[model samples]
Target: MTAWIILPVSLSTFSITGIWIVYAMAVMNHHVCPVENWVYNDSCSDDTAKHGYPKSCCTLNDVPLISKCGTYPPESCLFSLIGNLGAFMVVLICVLRYSQVLEQSHRSWVNTTALIAGCTNAAGLIIVGNFQVDYAKSLHYIGAGVAFPAGLLFVCLQCVLTYHIAATTLDLWMAHVRVTLSALALISLVFSGIFFIHDSFLLQHLAAVCEWIFVIDILIFYGTFAYEFGGISRDTIVTAIQHASSRACKSPGSSSTSTHLHCNPEGITMI
Candidate 1:
């Protein structure tokens, strides 16, 4: 079997490719201009949809956000599919990461908090995917609001954890990489938000660019986990579960008589 390292790689690959595919579809259908033109054009008009096949077009006054790229037909279905599957992958990766960290380093509040933030980020992704920005503006914004900040927090926490538990030179180097990526992600996120709210078309375009940069940065950070995750195997998950079950069996409320049924002599639990 392949190492669990594939999980993070798959998540990053599919998500980045999928979003770009949606953007391509939008461009092909005349729903939005090519990203290069959209960002650099001084003037844009929403009239393409009238001359073309699409029902809507992203004009200069309305910069195409990533979410906006999938608001229309065809691409919308792909977008939702990517969002839901990506969210599932994110959750899985988060769980595996938490388990790995707990085993390598002693459990701490940082690890626990990272897990929570990751889950929140995943939930936000699901919402963003299912709710198209044009159709459900409020809900879409809510999801973005939750996902972006939570994602930043998750990466920052993971960087700190990497530095805290780093033992080898490779681990220390990984910490440095993560710290740099986290800083860039933070800067992109802040500018994306700040520029998005402005009235100027160029500023809005810049915001869209920043949003893409932020997302790409996050995906790259996730990809970095593949190196560490290369060590994870089926036994890793089994061991983590066994540890949890044994801890539960030893809780104060559990009786010795029930303990034998819940846990084996080797401390492995049947359940």
Candidate 2:
């Protein structure tokens, strides 16, 4: 069987790395402002002077300036593509793993809710990546609007689910850590949103910083899934093999004694 624990860890790592790599590429190409500049713009142009603050301040809007990193076209396509696709895959796998965990723990409601939130987040990421801020402002903002809150909610639900399972199925300390990270992610997202609504340059910069914090926290939160992936993968594989064997033994024309040896009284495979 494959070492499934590597799946989530790989996806999370790729998502985080993709974002930073895109940011770096944008900065190198002068498509976006350097981190030190603090200014947020599609081109990092000094056009924010009219707002009374130096061009060093970041821009405040419903969508983050990072989404604009790919506005420069062909060269930046990889940036957006990697970020969007990586994030989508990460969330998709995360949702599946969480659902399995919840199902095993007998928390069906939480599993459903978390799956919905994770799917929403994944969809939002697709929108955000496809619609560059400079190309389609409305769509970009809409995507950002959906992604931010939904992502936070996903983390929150997962945190609750983790807490519930910690006593019986998971490590207590890991659950606590996940809960704390989820809380911090939500708080940072809220502050980021609040600051984005203000006109002050400093507030906007702070908002950008908070947004980064939220993203980082989310990546870390997802990384926690690494602990259970292997067990889940093993169980799933074993279950499949057992089911297959039971079917083979019960096939038509098979001897009753043979079927009795392979099948259980409950009509279920005992793996």
lDDT of 2 by residue, 85-187 (tens): 7666766575556545644664356667777787787788788888777778899889889888887888888777776666554477877888899889989
Q: Clashes in model 2: which pairs? A: 40-58
Clashes of each: 0, 1
Worst lDDT 10-window in candidate 1: 48-57
The global C-alpha lDDT for each of the candidates, from Candidate 1 onward, is 0.84, 0.69
Candidate 1 lDDT over 130-200, as tens digits, reads: 99998999999999999999999999999999998898999999999999999999999999999988877
C-alpha TM-scores of all predictions = 0.86, 0.74
Clashes of 2: 1
Q: List all candidate RMSDs to the true structure.
A: 3.3, 7.3
Question: Number of the top candidate by TM-score?
Answer: 1
Give the local distance difference test score of model 1.
Answer: 0.84
